[model samples]
Target: MSGRIVVGVDGSEPALKALKWAAAQAALTGDSLEVVTSWEYPASWSTMMPGVPTEFDPEQLAKEILNASLEKALDPATAAAARRTVVGGNPAQALVDTAKGATLLVVGDRGYSGFKAAVLGSVSTNVTQHAPCPVVVVRGESAAS
Candidate 1:
């Protein structure tokens, strides 16, 4: 089954590593890579004293972030293997949902973490557990190197 591989990306280093890994995998397998990013309006900003003109648009933000991330992830020489997608929602949910039709789902082990954890981030852990297809969580400096 030669289907597209979906990768979850943010601006984090780990996400970039995952994207690079996915790109190589796509090139090796002759499959397309779908880079996905999720964005959402922070609840604090969206609910400023019961709707006081929230100037945040989650969809637009997602699109912009996804585009930027994809451009950074894709190489001009390997453009044929890359595609981009933006989904506005919880990051874990978006990756899991997109994983349904993908041959594989690739994600970062940790992303923009505030606290140190021994394991993967909540989003990566959740996607690994719930994704419909095979999931790969890229981590460590070696992956990037």
Candidate 2:
């Protein structure tokens, strides 16, 4: 069977870096690239009160974020040769689940973070530990240097 490469994207700079690397790798290996993004509503946002429907829909938000991130990460030429996917759930869980059938899973070392001290983000670290396939964590440009 042909190889499949999956990359998790969230529109962050590190994610963009991962996407670029994944795209190039996919092109070189003739593997299909699947770009994935996960979105979830914060507990605080959903706990506004009883009887109030959560205005936030995780699936819809994920789709929007994935579309925007894909547009920014892949150029016309590169994207034309790849497939895109967006899933809704915890980023780590989503990535691990997607990796179940993938040849490799790629992710940024760090994603949208509230603190600079955080390393590899939670999702990246989790995937590296439990992914079904090989996992590649692309560090930030500064870290790469």
Among these predictions, the greatest TM-score belongs to 2
TM-scores for all candidates: the values are 0.82, 0.85
Quote model 1's TM-score.
0.82
Q: Against the unseen true structure, what C-alpha lDDT does each candidate score?
A: 0.81, 0.84
lDDT of 1 at 57: 68
Worst 10 residues of 1 by lDDT: 45-54
Cα RMSD for predicted model 2: 3.1
Quality of model 1 by C-alpha lDDT: 0.81
- Candidate 1 lDDT, tens digit per residue, 1-145? 5789999988788898888899899878887888888886567764554664566566776777666666676677664446777887899999999888889999998888775545788899999889999999998444335
For each candidate, how many residue pairs have backbone atoms clashing (under 3 Å)? 0, 0
